[model samples]
Target chain A: MNVLFQILFTISILTNGDIKVPNSGFQPGDKASDFDLKSVDGKNYSLASFKDAKGFIVVFTCNSCPFAVMYEDRIVELSKKYGKKGYQVIAINPNDPEVKPDDSYEKMKVRAKDKGFDFPYLFDDGQKVYPAYGATKTPHVFLLDKNHIVKYIGAIDDNAEDASQVEEKYLENAIAALDKGKEPVPAVTKAIGCSIKVKSK
Target chain B: MKVFTAIISLVFILSASKAQTQVLPEYDTYDSLSAAVFRNNDTTYVINFWATWCAPCVKELPYFEAFNKKYKEQKFKVVLVSLDFKRQIKSHLLPFITKNKIASEVVIMNDKKYDTWLPKVDASWSGSIPATYLVQGDKKLFAEREFANLEELEDFIFSFSKYK
Candidate 1:
């Protein structure tokens, strides 16, 4: 019985039994996995690059998805709002550049520069990193603590279409909670928006 | 003047009628099972997975409701399975169903463990709503994403009905 309890606890920590997200999304209380992927600026970025922060925001977004596009300015806005306070936001493009041509390196640079992105927009070529983070959508998010542990995973806000009617900002709340050393009030929320398009086999 | 008024009224009526045309809804339920419900029917099951938040899904819902109302007497039934969170079942889902007066059976998938059960349907589904599938006997039809109109849906149904 003790063995079963230990296994269940470990499973709960590793994979939320709810099965909402594939085993591929970051869950609360899990250690944020590290990887070196290309930033739109041609440099590589890893969790280590943002070491000076009290917490970090890792957003899985792309150039084409309308939902991601809608949230683009807000993503920059959030970074500007919180970056000065030691919270770093890193945007990762997890879609296969091949499957989604608009998501290619050149286009990523164009969009980032065109949009005046204040944060790094990293490439997820071969699409290996998002699965480690357990992200499912184009605008999927992962919030990490100063220690590189995942504090929250879900949408940036509740309303993607209407900012005026916004009810919740999952990432913002998690960042606030992490900054104060409090457990994020809601560790997980429903991840919405376009599914990340990976390379076809 | 009378003739102009008559023409304007006719145009108004035509556009108004077109506005009410129902669309078949689509959804990304996050999980779909092959539906043991498929076993009970000798007729085709035209299941359109949709959610309330999806605009195209909401627009196409009435057409599906109308299709079910019109053709359920024949070998056809439409099922609107909402992919919205079970928590939304009471708030957004039920109100949407009631508001639309959706006649077909409505089910909110309460299952959150999506990957385990969703793959049980087809591992290939990338979890988009507004997806559809039609099954009749040994024949299978799978649409990975949204449909354009009821004609597209009806074309499949009628074609399959003849083939069956």
Candidate 2:
């Protein structure tokens, strides 16, 4: 009986604990992975570069996704609003430019300038960082604490259309909860947007 | 006399545009969409979630249309659910559907609460486009990825409808 129980426990651990999902790289409570990706401002950025930061508002967004476009101003506002409050928004474009021509590096630069982005708009060249973070869609967000622990992962708010009608601001609430040293109520959420296009194999 | 002629030409243009227009896709919420998919009947439902902006979704649409036509002769129904924004129904979706000559029943799903409805469609769905849900009686299958070709999609449909 003891041997059977041990075998079943081992099997469950292998199947459930370490199950590998393609493109799903992180989960809530997982450590935030570091990346050295290029920014549109002609500079390289990494989480380690921010020495005094309390946390990061990491958003995976693209120029082409309509949902991303809808949330662009809101994302910018969040970055600016939270930057002084200790969280710096680090936006990353994870789409392959080959798949989405509008998401190319030059276009990203133009968009950054046109939108007057207050944060780093990094290009996930080779599309490595986002998959590691398990981001599936454009406008996906990951909030990390100072220790590089993922605190929140999901959408910016409840309402994608008509921001004024938004009753639940998921990202804002998470940031506020973190500010008060409390865990976010809903740590994970399902974000709806264009899928991150991978390089055709 | 000039005003009368102008009115006649305006009416002619309006009627001409109307001739090319097809019926707009009916919009559905999560509950209604789920109800439509899982009808509790023996007929297998092949539900595809797509959008106008998704390249892969648009690419595989023809395959779905062909399958819908082929399966119409059998115990299968294909529902192409459009995730297009409600406002774009007239401007983009209606014209695209007409231009493409899609034969399948297309429905606009403007429900933005993906978090609530995604699991209801399929627990495995990561809220990605080009997803397909198959349901028949008690059996349900969901694919979160796009079909590479018609054969692949057909294989999925055939597998579900074989014993139905």
Candidate 3:
């Protein structure tokens, strides 16, 4: 009994010290994990698929949230403007469809088509990718370099309600800074957004 | 004579409708809002950051209402701090509050400086709605997720009570 108790205590200490907490994703300067999620186009995409890309604008968004909907057009515009610059935008829907029916894969396809998205809009099936990246809300972004290093995280800009009234384009500025070989000033930001839906236990 | 009667009825209807209308206080900045609601006093303040558009927030609102109702006589207060857009306050927020007959004190937090104000609420907060902050005389408890039920909310608030 004494030997068994000692072994159990040693295992507990090892587990507690090494394990990463769920949903506490990668922070700045941390190496982000690559995912092979299915896109709305029915094709699988991973960071490795984008061979020529210098960096990626990996935004975790969904179909239903008002804040996500508000930023949809802006996300499209970012892909268009930044694609040529070798910084590709990869959109992912991380909400569990069981919790929010509107975020179903079919609706995501419709949304992607309707928005004329020029980028790969992937679905984080099983609700895996966002938690791995630490996304807490719809429209949260993780700016990663070619080396898969998370350089920035948070909102796309200063404003979520109105794009026209936006004063600072955080994502755009981050890309611009990278182009000039400088670090993003405010490495992380926060914006009021719908909490990422997960099925209730 | 007919016009006089019509005018009197109009005035009575207007006054009666005004009595039914719920007056929602709007705060354009977080500093002013924190000053009013997050008072450093003996009263335990349960400040819930929520919005009308957030489904989880809407789902868990009744629990907050029930909690408020149960604790009204005590040195406790429930303030529903709405993160709804300023433009939608009239069209979306007001109607929802009035229709639900929400008795808890509701106020709009329209400040756009989320990066600055969100950390002030709780350093661990990631700007998600349905977050609850329970406070009394500097003792604070912040929950970044929705309360499952009234008991859960009561348990959260009571957990802070154990401090003092």
lDDT of 2 by residue, B8-110 (tens): 9999999999886676546457887676556788888889988887888898999899888877878888889998877788788888988998889888887
Q: Count the backbone clashes (under 3 Å) in each candidate.
A: 22, 0, 0
User: CAPRI verdict on model 1?
Assistant: incorrect
Cα-lDDT of candidate 1: 0.73
Residue pairs in steric clash, candidate 2? Answer: none
Maximum-DockQ candidate: 3
Task: Pick the winner on TM-score between candidates 2 and 3.
Answer: 3
Q: By TM-score, highest first, what's the ranking? A: 3, 2, 1
lDDT of 2 by residue, A119-201 (tens): 99999998889889988888899999998899998899988877887878999999899989999988987756788888656
Give me the candidate number with maximum TM-score.
Answer: 3
lDDT of 2 at B155: 93
Q: How close is candidate 2 to the true structure, as a TM-score?
A: 0.87
- Model 2: CA > 4 A from native: A1-23, B1-28
- Model 2 chain B: weakest 10-residue lDDT segment is B20-29
Q: Which DockQ value does candidate 1 get? A: 0.11
lDDT by residue for model 1 over A151-191, one digit each (tens)?
Answer: 88767876666566677777788887887889987776653
Per-residue lDDT of candidate 3, residues A32-134 (tens digit): 9999999999999999999899999999999999999999999999998999989989999999898889999999999999999989999999988888899
Q: Which sections of candidate 3 miss by over 4 Å?
A: A1-23, B1-21, B162-164
